[model samples]
Target chain A: MSTPSTSSAPAEAGPRDKHALAAAIARDVPDGAYVNLGIGQPTLVAEHLREGSGVVLHTENGMLNFGPVATGDDVDLDLTNAGKIPVTELPGAAYFHHADSFAMMRGGHLDVCVLGAFQVSANGDLANWHTGAPDAIPAVGGAMDLAIGAEQVWVMMTLFAKDGTAKIVPTCTYPLTGLACVDRVYTDLGTFELAASRGRADGAVVVRDLSGISLEELGGRLDVPVVLG
Target chain B: MSAASILASYADAVADVEDGATVLVGGFGMAGMPVELIDALIEQGAKDLVIVSNNAGNGDTGLAALLAAKRVRKVVCSFPRQSDSWVFDGLYRAGQIELEVVPQGNLAERMRAAGAGIGAFFCPTGVGTPLTEGKETRVIDGRTYALEYPIKGDVALIKAHRADTMGNLVYRKTARNFGPVMATAARTVIAQVSEVVPLGGLDPEVVVTPSIYVDRVVCPTAQES
Candidate 1:
């Protein structure tokens, strides 16, 4: 929402738009890697993948080697992503049932996965499934599996909540999805990496890139310890 | 011999469904949802059912309509809340229906364990999370895992792309989710396919589900085709 105007906006503004954030994360994806993009904002990474990158897309609903979004006659209700949107199949596309599909993840067959998170603790504990709010219907689709299964779990989200509260905190108040699972975070304002310690409260945050904020201001905003990568 | 009975009508297919049956309904959403069969089950008037699925319901149709009819007593699924799931949201808030949310992969693999005749398995999916609370936890090879049990169903209603007269089934793309596994996990498996081929019409190698797992087959769409 902090994206500046095309002509006068600073190259590195306060917060980049979702498209720019997606492009940055998509570029970070290694070549020839198998990746799963979570539903919602993370799904945009698929469209920005480099051409001929050989990046195979996996959907938890039972598909691999799937291509970008399908339009026109290419649309098939049966062929879709984890988000259940119409998608295309690559030449080496394969389809299995839900069991085999999740096996690809829980069996350590995936290279990376990008997920959205509500809160990420200093030690990389992720809490995205539920807010623990009253009258909330908690729905966790392959989050727990994907969190622990992927070789590297990258998060794509906003750095702060709408009320200006930092989501990257010393501890998370939401129900935990996975303990010490996140490796990196790509947000609207900045990017960060975590020296994650599983089951331990000692996590060191590293600021990899910054757009709109200074290191001092960012550190002041967050309660956790952070340093330059 | 295969126990697959070819039924002429979808309503007759689900007529024998008794009350309090734990049914596994297959689909990732609307892709492989057995809409006609569910409509038929609604007409069949079976009540107090436990529905197992990946999602509770999306819109006001298929499983949503089933929930709307006050037939389901509980839903055992991974994801029950979605933007279009107002019907389930209403029922859940009113405390009329009970819910058990499992992780998506665990939901699939649990049924797979049942189909494979495995007693129980240790999985790292929900380790140290609230989803695995009160369950047995083990340290295997230095990694933590929670003990998981199989989820067997009394009846499984699924949709497939094609099925042979012998009940060998194949599914289309992502729509194939939970169908093949549910077929084996259930005591009685019923399938609604778009096409019904002859016994030898389908190749054996590409068949996702063999005839041994299926109990019945119906093709209302084939008549339309």
Candidate 2:
């Protein structure tokens, strides 16, 4: 493995260093799991771990056991994540065939995959790729593999975009990545789960806001009924 | 003769196809291509079909419908977006589907090569990584390149804005995705269009895909939900 920061001590591992949502994700992730953390906000989960736990991180571009973001200038050019960002390779990490990496995804070998989304439907439908907007740059990469291949799908995103628009909606107008693929959704607001109802076997998904946002406040932006807790 | 050799409405034409056929969908992300026809294929219950697209849709719409129905057994795509957790994350966790991910550029080239009747081509994509497994690799210019075979399908589903009676097609804006290349890559090319015009109505220069490749055309259905 490549060593970029051997001099510095590992950052303090605890929940306070992370926000509430990050703490929730750390709580959900199990030990000795093969995990693929999606790019963007999902990558932040790497920064917070339960210290001394074994979580093998896999990057789609052929990397395993990558460390969190850079702490100092100790960078390794050869080792990086899927997004081409410099990442530290943890101990006991080894390089494998890229095909094997995909095989781990395609062959149902992944334990968990944390991702970001634009809109998550009440029925657990995901439509974060194409918004069907006129100028939207359309692309839906590995989202499918991580969506269907992983044993558990956990989403981490803000309740709304920077524009104050709700990222979670009743239905996704954009092109979908998978149907009812979401198992659990985590946001800055609260957590949500898909429940079964009469008509839909998978049932209606309910969003429980923990961020103190009133149900009526979230109801106005979303099309589904909010079961206030 | 294949049904591709005889057809009037692409909507009515694909009824002859049986289940379990492989489909190659063309486009880069949500760029130019036939989206309308994809809906029809789904409604047509083209079950057990192997689908090739850029990426699976995020949720209930687009390519995700097939995934939800469990109709697609294998998916061959290039770029699976990470930002959207809807499809890739969901399916990856359930372990219900098979994925063959190639580099975005290599994916497009392989599709192009298939349509152009090329057996195989070489590129540096997926060489050093795991993408090179069970495949041939060659060195060019002292750099390693993998031999990627052409990707063709039993049925080619495409979407376009306008078409002539002879099957010449035109795309509008980002919809022009993968139109030209995908048209020639399949044994049967089924197209869906918003409008169909007389053969001479379209300008010869603007036609992206010639009528020679298209076998049928269907008007957009309003009830496609």
The numbered model that scores best in lDDT is 1
List runs of model 1 lying over 4 Å from the truth: A1-13, A196-203, B221-225
**Per candidate, chain B TM-score?**
0.97, 0.86
- On DockQ, the candidate that comes out on top is 1
Q: How close is candidate 1 to the true structure, as a TM-score?
A: 0.95
Residue A114, candidate 2: how far off, in angstroms? Answer: 25
Candidate-wise lDDT, in order: 0.89, 0.64
lDDT of 2 by residue, B24-85 (tens): 77543444335555665667777877787766654455576657767787787765544543
Per-residue lDDT tens digits of candidate 2, residues A16-61?
2225566667667898788888877788776665787688888765
Off by over 4 Å in 2: A1-229, B1-11, B29-33, B81-88, B220-225
Clashes per candidate, residues 3 or more apart or on different chains: 0, 49
Query: What is the TM-score of each predicted model, taking all chains together?
Result: 0.95, 0.48
Candidate 1: tens digits of C-alpha lDDT, residues A94-154: 9999999899998999999999999998778899999899989989999999999999999
Q: Which residue pairs in candidate 1 have backbone atoms (N, alpha carbon, C) closer than 3 angstroms, thus clashing?
A: none
Scored against the native two-chain complex, candidate 2 gets a DockQ of 0.04
